[model samples]
Target: MIDLAPHDETDTTALKERERFAQILVLFGRHGLKGLAARLGLGAGGGEPLEDTRPEAIVALLRDIGPVAVKFGQILAMRSDLLEPAWVDALSKLQDRVPPLPFAAVQPLIEEAIGGPIETSFSHFETEALAAGSIAQAHAATLLDGRDVIVKIRRPGIERIVDADLRLLRRLARVAERRIPEIARLKPDELLRHFAESLAREMDLSAEARASDAIGEYLKTYGVRTARFDWELSGRRVNIQERLRGFPASDLDAARRSDLDLATLASTYAQAILRMIIINGHFHADPHPGNVFFLEDGTLGLIDFGAVGTLLPRRREELVRLGLAIASEDTGGVVDILMLWAGDPDVERVRLEEAMAELIDRFSNVLLDQIDLADIFQMVFAILRDFHLALPPDLALVLRTLLTAEGFVRRIDPAFDIARELAPIAKELMRERASPARLRGEAGKLLAALGRAVLSTPNLVGQIEKVARTGSITVSIAPKDLERLRGRERAGRGTPQLYPATLAICAAIVFSSQPLLAGLLAFGAVALAVFEGVRRR
Candidate 1:
């Protein structure tokens, strides 16, 4: 997270800062949120005229305030778990489009970055930008070897502009929470800090280049690949990567006109992204139309790795369980998972369960393919809001990413079902759970834990003995631990004590005389000790 200078760390009283702060207030006032501005300590709190406060007005306000504000709104758009449909829709459609900066403006920086001149790296260069966003712009170019590449240059002087905006926003958030009681639910300060960190990652062109390499692949029929980067020429401010081939994924006309099988592509794209999220936990958070493409090679290509979502393995498991519970109409299970997510054990279980049962009943007759996820998400968020519980930020991001992806995928093939992907995904998830590799990993973990406990047992036993001596306490081992009670069962070569083990060889050899039973006896002893060690642990 970008650490903003507190009052003591920097000169908050600087004139340049004061001017920028006033300018932000003026921009908000111009956008018809003068009351909001006043509440944020911009002006007198009462007796102020404010214009339209509709969703569109909010979008316009952010866009007008510039890149930082626009990016913040874009992040908020992904928070369907916190926002109503109208606001999320309006903000989701909000674009961070800015007029391209002239190549002449960035030529000096590019030449210095490459340690020479543009001609030294590129034989052919297009001055015009391939695309322009709030943070950076991409230019098409060709290397001396006749390879097509894209050069993304961070906007010059953007750091200064963004730094100023962040400081102003931070100050405003601190005061707004106090002045406007309702704004506390939004947790403005934390959101602003997170936005700063996300923007910082996006602003670093080289970081975006590295992220593309880590993005996972889907089924062979399912998808495409990321652009290859040139690390030699890439840096924090400038990135050069091979250009990819594809039509924008959101272009329905292109999807229909091409020979590509929309049915297969739709499911593949849906499942591929879901696997990235549900299976691997790292996924492209912003899969909006502009960031995804249907490749000329008959595959779905994804780009723009600046924003991504991550789900913890534990959370992913809960999600799977929640999905299963919903599908099976296990109302109690659904309520249990929801309460766990809500993190409130004392919540009214009956009320939550009744609500889940109603939700399940509402969709019970509907086929999985026909159920509207958008509608379901809205109702669920409403329930969460009613209970005064907010969805975790990561889960919120997943919901938004899923909904965003589903929007474009359906645009290709309307009948394609996202729910259909879940069953297969869940099957794979179950298979993974029972896979031998996973079982071995679990066993190894258990063994390690038992080993640790056993190694520390002497110290624990000493403390316990001391405590027991203080009182006339009784100590007894349970029946399950009776094997451990046999302390004198030695397995040495010439030992007198009998080796006790369940193995037939040891059982027979100990009962009947046998010399080579040492190995079997030792194996049986260690196995029993480890098993009991784990049980005690």
Candidate 2:
């Protein structure tokens, strides 16, 4: 028997809320509500179809599920590939319409997070939230020293609810993995782990503050100034940052009024994204329109550093190679780079090659100026889907951000092409391949790897001979032993243990036969054994 009871005092309310939500699911199912209602178990009760005209009912159900589900729906809305357009449109409304926590309830949280009274920390503060998102809300305020800032406070009880929901989700994911073979292809368990990490980061305001400061410093190093919030007054639950007064980038009317060059601004923004990816190897994972602003001076302001993407040095290098391969229309090179990054050499190389070729053919004839970023991205995503390639989470986030930024840029300036803007950057990166310093470093690395392999070759050969003579091998198995063994067996043409077990059974059969028949059976067994050994080797 599993204990489903709440573990802490703070979790009791969340547990009750979840039970209520379950009841609501049953009621909705009983009334024959929407399809999603049935999927959510809201339609568990048997009843006549109910009228679906109640938008309020839908909103109420979402609110009852708490902040994490609301946020999930909001993000799902952005993934047009995952849901119907109508559903996406409906969920987009959730962006600005999440119910705001009461003003009285919010002030105390701010004071508690910052310590002491709200007045002591801020010269003036707005009681009402300036904006309300699923996880947190931002309020306008002025520091005691007179600096304008915005204070972001996490909604009360959100962390508790999120933890409960995620625990349930993780359990569900494990069940899904066991029941669905296709789910393993997508790595549902790893995806859940990623979601947990992202949610945890979002809940920690201190982490976001550090990310913002790091990005700001990186930008400054490149002589690019962007809006960043002050973290001196920030804490785990509260983030106080310099208030930025700017129009949303999507506001075309304001751009015109301010005489901002949409094309130049789009180019600059695209460049900044490229820099974040290629130079720093760290980038804002979410660059949706709502998270970016355009100031009157044409400086782009990026906010919400909670979600970020980071690539390991090796992956970064592979990405550089991939970018070059794309630019040069080298389909084979692109496929090779993808295989290296995938960490699975036995994956269907032919399928990957074909996918890469098709993707390259789609844009091969198009000039950089004529290539729309969205179209290129759609082709790449199509290829990924066709090949069933699972991208690393961080890499996937980077691609999503780039796609979103391209869309935003296109909306602002119809003629601004992100592909064209990135062409020169891509060319420069490709040129790095031939740079003397780069070539020398590559040579050194290659020599060092070869040296290590050469030194180990004799010992490896000796071990192989010893194993062959002894008919046994002593291998230290680690946590990933099974996966590593499977890979080695596939690559080395080695027989799995099951094959040897079958051979042993054949030998037993021969031994049990009569003397005359046994001799013939022994010959047959030897022949089968030879064939099996030759096939395996």
Candidate 3:
């Protein structure tokens, strides 16, 4: 086990830590998680440690910890590589459903953020909240120019609350890493850093506004409808945007009542999402029923831009390669793509190839129309998990977004096949990959890498020569390996001591008349013990 070294104490730090600890303890007690608390060495005054980490307990813990923690859990839910399926399923249900703060409580903050009181900020502002979440509440309003909009007000004092909780979470992550051996591979610190950055971006309304504008522009280019954010009225804590009124995607009955064509809507929405991922390489990470709406004019409107994912050019290219390779049933191509995309060199090639072959064989016999894209993707992810390969954060989020989209679209039309839809996109991507411009770019990159390698060859060779001459080399082992080595050494020591002592005692009994044999056995025992002590030293 690793040590969780304590931080230096100060008046303010101590107070904040104490408050955070107390809140955690209380929440743990409320959720009957005293056992978990005890396991973290935060024993609930007088309680036993919980030996098992059940899925339900994890959900309860995150729920009671508050919004940021809840959000963290939701994000973690997508990380199948880091968690069991049951844990992921439980955490995926986290929602930001906190009760709305009273309008009076948020009014002052909104006025200050928007540079005026409600009377001057807008032509008409409602006191009642239209929607509420853990971080902010939305109210219906009308702009001075007579445009209907929604004003989202950040909860009073939320910034401090979230910030403090984040600090506590960082400390807790550290503790978890040290105390829980299994979690080290998950790199809790790095995961927390990513979570913190994502949360920070979410807290800034301007950032969300910028993301919305970028995504809106891209989607509009493809004739996909999206809401536009009014930057003039947006601030750090207040977001003003065009008010969207329509049947939520989840309301199937409402859609039918409006005589909406479910088939067309399903196809259009699926195509738009595919374009967002494969063509534009930027997408809304969360496209759940709650965030999607169908306008009266048949346009699909997506809201809640706080969570988004972007795919880099190379990563996008790799995904295209992966799809095409899978279609061809080429195990080597799949393996190459995994190595390049995930950047994990330690994966066992034979095992990965065998897994990919099995996956290909299973899917190859099925017709395109019969294949389920989401199931295929899940199988691929399962292979990666088995090999201890983890996708980059952006890729993981994009995959989850695609999976969610597939599920949502399929709900509208049971016969909808994402695989059939994706086939053409994959082929197009392959064609693009082989295009003159792309080939030239790839060739240039290859040459540059080769040039660097050639220039550094002599220096690399010199280092190897120097190391050989000095006979100096060091090997670093993982904690798990080191622990095993220690265990073997301990067992080896005990056997030597026991065997020699046993032999001496047996000799003393059997050779009582033979003084020489008895003496030899006793001497051997003493010698073996001394040799063992020296080896230990």
TM-score of each: 0.77, 0.73, 0.80
Q: Where does candidate 1 stray beyond 4 Å?
A: 1-13, 47-52, 216-223, 342-349, 436-537
Show model 2 residue runs off by greater than 4 Å: 1-64, 73-97, 181-184, 221-225, 340-348, 431-437, 459-537
TM-score rank, highest first?
3, 1, 2
lDDT per residue (tens digit) for residues 1-537 in model 2: 222334564776667755755664564444335454433333433322223334445555555556665665555444433333455567767643576788898878887877789877878889888888767898888888888888899888878768877765565456546544544455657766877888888899888888888887887654345456666667888888876678776667777788777777777777877778876788887777777777656677777788888866676677876866787776656866665545554555555666676778777887777777767766665566556665676676676777777888778778876567777776777687679998898667655655555575687557544544565646465645566446445544343334543443343444434445544543444445444443222
Ranked candidates, highest lDDT first: 3, 1, 2
Q: Per-prediction count of colliding residue pairs? A: 0, 5, 0
User: Model 3: per-residue lDDT, tens digit, 320-389?
Assistant: 6676668777666677777765665665565677788898998778877787777887788778777777
List, residue by residue over 59-131, the lDDT tens digit for candidate 1: 8877877888888888888776566778888998877888999999988878988999999999999999889
- Better-scoring candidate (TM-score), 2 or 3: 3
Which 10-residue span in candidate 1 carries the lowest summed lDDT?
488-497
User: Which stretch of 10 consecutive residues in model 3 shows the poorest summed lDDT?
Assistant: 488-497
Worst 10 residues of 2 by lDDT: 44-53
RMSD of each: 11.0, 11.2, 15.5
Q: Is candidate 1 or candidate 3 better by TM-score?
A: 3
